[model samples]
Target: MDQTQSSSKALTLARHVLRVEADAVAALADRLDGAFDEAVALILARRGRVIVSGIGKSGHIGRKIASTLASTGTPAYFVHPAEAIHGDLGMIQRDDALIALSNSGESAELLTIVPIIKRQGAKLIAMTGNAASSLAREADVHLDAGVTQEACPLNLAPTASTTAALALGDALAVALLDARGFSANDFARSHPGGTLGRRLLTHVRDVMRSGDDVPSVTPEASVAEAILEISRGGIGMTVVVSAERRVVGVFTDGDLRRAFAQDIDLRRARLADVMTPRPRTLAPDRLAVEAVEMMEHFKINQLPVVDDAGTLVGALNMHDLFQAKVI
Candidate 1:
C-alpha cells in the first residue's frame, strides 16, 4: 500500500477500535441488574479481603481492578489463577470473597479452582462474556461483561470484552464505596503518597510557622515597627496583637502601600491606626487545603493561625504552602 493509503487505513482502524470499546462500556450500564447488586452485597458483607483472580489479558485488568478496590476502601488483592492451582488458593478464607475474571467463562484454571473455593465457603463472583458458561453457573453471582464484537479487526482478540470487564469492576467498586459511606478522608489514608492524600491529610499546624517564626507586633507599635516585623518574617505580613498575644488586626504589604499613597508617616502612625482590623484567621487544626481555599477566596497571600481563644499561635503564607507541597 502507498504511504498515504496505509496512514488513512490505520487512522480509520484506530477510530473503529475506540468506538467499539466505548460502545461496550456504554452497553454495561443497560445490562446491569440484580446480579450486579448481589455482587456488591456479597463483597460488602464479607469479613475478609477480596481476592481477584484471572489469567492473561484478564489478569492485567484484574490487577488494576484490585488496586482500585484497595485504594477506594475495599480490602482487595490479585491472585493469578495459575498460581492458585498450585498453592495460592490457601489465601482464600471462608470469610473472604473471590472475583474471577474470564472473558470466555470457560478458563480451565479458574474452573479447576471453583469447586475448591466453594468447598471452603468463600463466595464466588464471576465476570464473563458467556453467561451460560460453566464458571457463571457455579458462581454465587455472575456479572455479564459481554460485548457484541472485539475492537480487534480480526474479531478474535479480547479488546472490547476486557474493557467491558474493567468498567464493570470499577462500577462494583464505586457502588461498594457509596454503600459503605467511604469518604475522601478514608480514600486518602490508603494513598498517603498521592496528591489527594497531601491535600486531605495535611493540616495547617503541620505547615504553618509557629513560635518566633511568626511575625507579630503590639497594637501600640509604630507602623514602621510592623513593617520591620513583616520584613523579618519574610511572609509579606505581620499580625497586630494585644498584651496577651491575641490577634487584634493585621498589617500587610497592601497596607504599607496604602499608607504610602495616603502620605501617612510610617514612623508616626501606630499599627492600630493603619492595620486591617478583624482580619480573616485560620485555626491551626484546619486542613491546609481549607487554608488554600480561604486564601484564594479572599485573594490574600497570608493568614495568621489562631487558637480557639483567638490567640495568635502561628502564621502561614502562599510560599509556606508551596514549600510544604500543600498548595
Candidate 2:
C-alpha cells in the first residue's frame, strides 16, 4: 500500500516479463529443426532482396526483423500487409523473396496477396503459429513460430507468440550472417552513424594522435626527458624510437612507478634502462576496438601505432578509445 511497496511490485512484474520472454526465446533454440534449414536455404538462394510483410502487432515485429536482416547483410525491407493490397505489392519482384508473418497463418490481407505474389514468381517464406494453415501450405518454406502459451495474463494478447517470432527472426539473420562470412566491418558499414559502428570500423589512424602530437624519445634520452614527453603529450606514456624513428620500446606510468619502487634513479637513468622492450603496438589500419582489446588484455593504457616498417606514426590511449566508444 505504501510507495516503496508499489515500486517493489512494479520491479517484480518487470523482472517476470523479462524472464518469460527469455524463456520463450530459449524454447525456439530447441525447436530449430529441418524447417529452419529450409527457410535459410530459401533466403540464401534468392538473388534479389527480401520483402517482409505482416499486419497488426506482427507488423512491428516484421519491421524489426527486416531491419536486422538489412544490417546483417540480408538486404530486406518491410511492406505493410494492408498497404500491399493497395498497390504496394509492386515493391516485390519476380527475383525477390517474400517473408510473411501471421500468427494464425490466415490473415485476410496477407492471404489475398499470396496468390498474386506466387504469380509474380517470387519465393514465399511463411512464419506462423499454424503449420497446416493456407499460408504455410502455399509458402516455398514454412517456419513454425508456435508457442504453447502466452506470457500475457490474458490469453487474448500476443506476447509469447511475438517473442517467439522475434527470436526466430534473429536466429535467421545470424545464421545467414555466418553463412555469408559477414565480418564485424561489414556490419559496421550498415550502422556507420552509431557508437558500435565507430568502435568496429574506426582505425588506429582515425583516432590516434599523429605527426607532431606523437610523444617519443631516443635511446640516449634521460628518464627525465621521457617524463617531460609523457606530461607534455598528456597520454601517460611515450614511445622510444631508434634513429630512423622506428619504435623500439615504450615507457609508461606503471613502468615509472615500478622503477621507483625498485630504487632506480630517474635523475641519472637512460630511457633505455627503464623502458619496456618491444611494447605492443597497433598498425595504423587496425580497428580501434582491436586496440582496446589489446590494451585491456595486456593491462596497458597507451599504445604506439606504427607503419609497416615499424616507424611510430601515432599514439593512442584509453581516453582515445573512450572518446571513440571502443570501450
The candidate maximizing lDDT is 1
Tens-digit lDDT track of model 2 for 234-254: 999989999999999999998
Best-fitting candidate, scored by TM-score: 1
Local accuracy by lDDT, each model: 0.94, 0.91
Output the lDDT of residue 147, model 1: 96
Q: How accurate is candidate 1 locally (lDDT)?
A: 0.94
What are the models' TM-scores? Answer: 0.98, 0.83
Evaluate model 2: give its lDDT: 0.91
Lowest-sum lDDT 10-residue window in model 2: 147-156
* Candidate 1 residue runs with Cα over 4 Å from true position: none
